[model samples]
Target: MGKPTGFIEYDRIPSPVRDPLTRTRDWNEYSLPMPVVDLQIQAARCMDCGVPFCHTGEEIKNGVSGCPLHNLIPEWNDAVYRGEWREALDLLLKTNNFPEFTGRVCPAPCEGSCTVAISEPAVGIKSIEKAIIDRGFEEGWIQAQAPQKRTGKRIAIIGSGPAGLACADQLNKAAHNVTVFEKSDRIGGLLMYGIPTMKLEKDSINRRVNLMAEEGVEFVTNIEAGKDIPMAQLKAEYDSVVLATGAGNARDVKLPGRDAKGIHFAVDYLTQSIKDNLDNGGVQTLSAEGKNVIVIGGGDTGADCVATALRQGAKSIYQFGLRDKLPDLRAIQNPWPQYPKVFQMDYAHSEAEAVYGADPRQYLVNSTEFIKNEKGELTGLRTIDVDHVDAERNLVEVPNSEKIWDAEIVLIAIGFAGATPSIFKDFKVAKTNRHTIEAAKGFYRTDVEGIFACGDARYGQSLVVTAINEGREAAREVDFYLMGETFLP
Candidate 1:
């Protein structure tokens, strides 16, 4: 929109990243910032289509296509193209309460539905977003904007993940006193611990948490609501309560030797790594050095395991997925404007390939059991080939396809099932058959009056953007419940 022919004249460019070999030595962010001028050029690539599917944030069958926060993508893209960074930041913050987190870690479905992507590569919308927020910080434009008047209403938000933070931000803006309770030692919940530092640095989370604190949002850490603190106290003290606790009960693989000592859950391993990196002078309690590491899932968490193992100087690493290899390009079943689940190298896989001789991912493989040593420590794994049929059919394990691979340590990266036990019992919230909080789709309210839920706890989650959207929607509902009206737009 800035220059009528900018989409034709300019090509999409991603932010520069350090060479994989050079970056794995430490747990620091590797993506180098794109220059302001180059970012502007990339922003110029937005066609800002009449339909603007990029901001519609709707899900089509199995895939989501656009920004779930309904971010003013076109407006901000134009503002960035014209060097109005302050305005761009304002527009971004209008919907997404935390751009710093999403800009770094979100998969950027907005690009998948971009009007420009129909013909050519999509504009570097994610990189432009990151640059806008980074520049906002650098130029002192980002600050604490506490409300001038208080409605004298109080709200308690359980869990300090993205959803809770987003809800607190909006509620505070509505002049309500908000307090976020986190079970972990620090705020930011999964953002602080569950995710690896290489992708989203801890400092970025700290920056936002500090700002939120200045804006009068109180954060209490190490006090779990169901255990250390009582849920009755929370319910009695606050006018309303919002349950934003994420779904953290990890799904476990039921194998013959699952009780082996060296086998760990992906969340546990990742949390320990983050704790070691942030607190203990970078001394890891469980190092994968000189060992054969096997990651038993191929999602983002499994990829993170690969990268962390590489950083720990593991001798070898292998990642296994039950599904067949995805096509490098979109398949016939997947059409335009849908997020393609095609094969691509994430940062960790890129780093693993750089250090090892080849990519560490193996498709259509399933771990049968953990092979152990005399001391009951994990020494290796037994795996077999698997075939997926229709939804009604079971996974058929191929005969004569079993194999054993040396594995000193095994990390299970299978996804989570639902919220942890304490959240459900403490709050007494109703749950669906899937064990997630029972909330009608898009309406994040519980059967109990004055109680609400959102994020992974509400919808079981698909992405961080979805969680942010849930938080925004939940805040609107909470506002209406309290004041009989709302102004959350």
Candidate 2:
């Protein structure tokens, strides 16, 4: 450890956010870089726990903790504390293929399992990671290095999302020719579209894509695998095929008046916004300007919808959550070393508070009906408070609690239920109960030989880091299947 007692001396600090009044006018990232010295101080707080559970992502008794990527947290923290920026970057890149993306958006389960967090606040691990990668980029440390030899094996990776990109990166390093196919206009699937610009700038995604291209990975955009290019053609053209297409189909709310004109899916609204931003310099589809917007669901996607609506000059915004309000502090049930479900405002919530003079969140509420105007356009919604019981574990509306609220535009941001079933059926791949690709335990393979799946398509979730892990693991399986042995670590 570079600083033995640094954890006792320093307090946790995070990066600063842009002022709400000024930042809401543009579609750019709202986070400001913390000073390098301050970042180093934060890195020094990683304690010398005998068993650093932060990197051991195993589910102990069905409750998983720490990073899924098993990042070398304490090692890199020591490197940063010793002012070894390049060493820290080297250590970071060993496991994580895209630290910049994870550092920006990951929920930081590593911090939740931090030994020091049992008493004091956890070390600013995410911030330290961001600083390390940004410093690497600025110092010309990150560059393209193509393999010297070619194995003459070709791999066709379907979908250019995080999982596909990670697989391509690894297979390319093994001297195989790799080409990534994307259905959208851009290479990054969700990162380039689904996420709001205020959280993750498109330029950051572009930088990595460009580097991957330079490293002998071919990117083909605007190519839908099933429709434009048949599955038979891909199998014949390439020796191996990897399905990394994400779980993009959104879960919908089927209440009355669901087909109203102003109602939209979260992914549709977000994807259109990103396309419009890239094409015409601003959002065009589903404008919220001067309209009362009600966003249903209380996850990161919903928060992003709130931020995007605010940027679109919405008249008033309201976010509804089906779950009960969470306590501000950790509860007895959620003890230390577990990822506590406590209340903490995210970036979008903070911005909404500044503009609307109040938090937009309304908990323990569910919409029963969507009110419509004379023209059949959505006008408002009827909502009610609900109670939860273990025996009768369904949302029961409160007595006389129904009320109508203005809602010109409604965005459903409920989470995804599972992966798209069409692609799996087209390829004759099996699925588990969750509708994700059915892979044997610890081995990511499909029913058919020479075909495999991973990432959101396989596990149905996780962080960017977990997606990368799945991709790396699947690539190793493919390698072993091809050559009868693999040296991938």
Q: Please tell me which predicted candidate would have the highest lDDT against the true structure.
A: 1
Off by over 4 Å in 1: 388-394
Off by over 4 Å in 2: 60-64, 390-394
Predicted candidate 1 versus true structure: per-residue lDDT over 210-244, tens digit per residue: 99899999999988876776777877899988999
lDDT of 2 by residue, 261-291 (tens): 8999887888888888888778467799999
The TM-score that candidate 1 achieves is: 0.97
Candidate 1's error at 134, in angstroms?
A: 0.5
> Least accurate stretch of 10 residues (summed lDDT) in model 1?
387-396
Clashing pairs in 1: none
Q: For model 2, what is the alpha-carbon lDDT of residue 85?
A: 96
Assess every candidate by TM-score.
0.97, 0.97
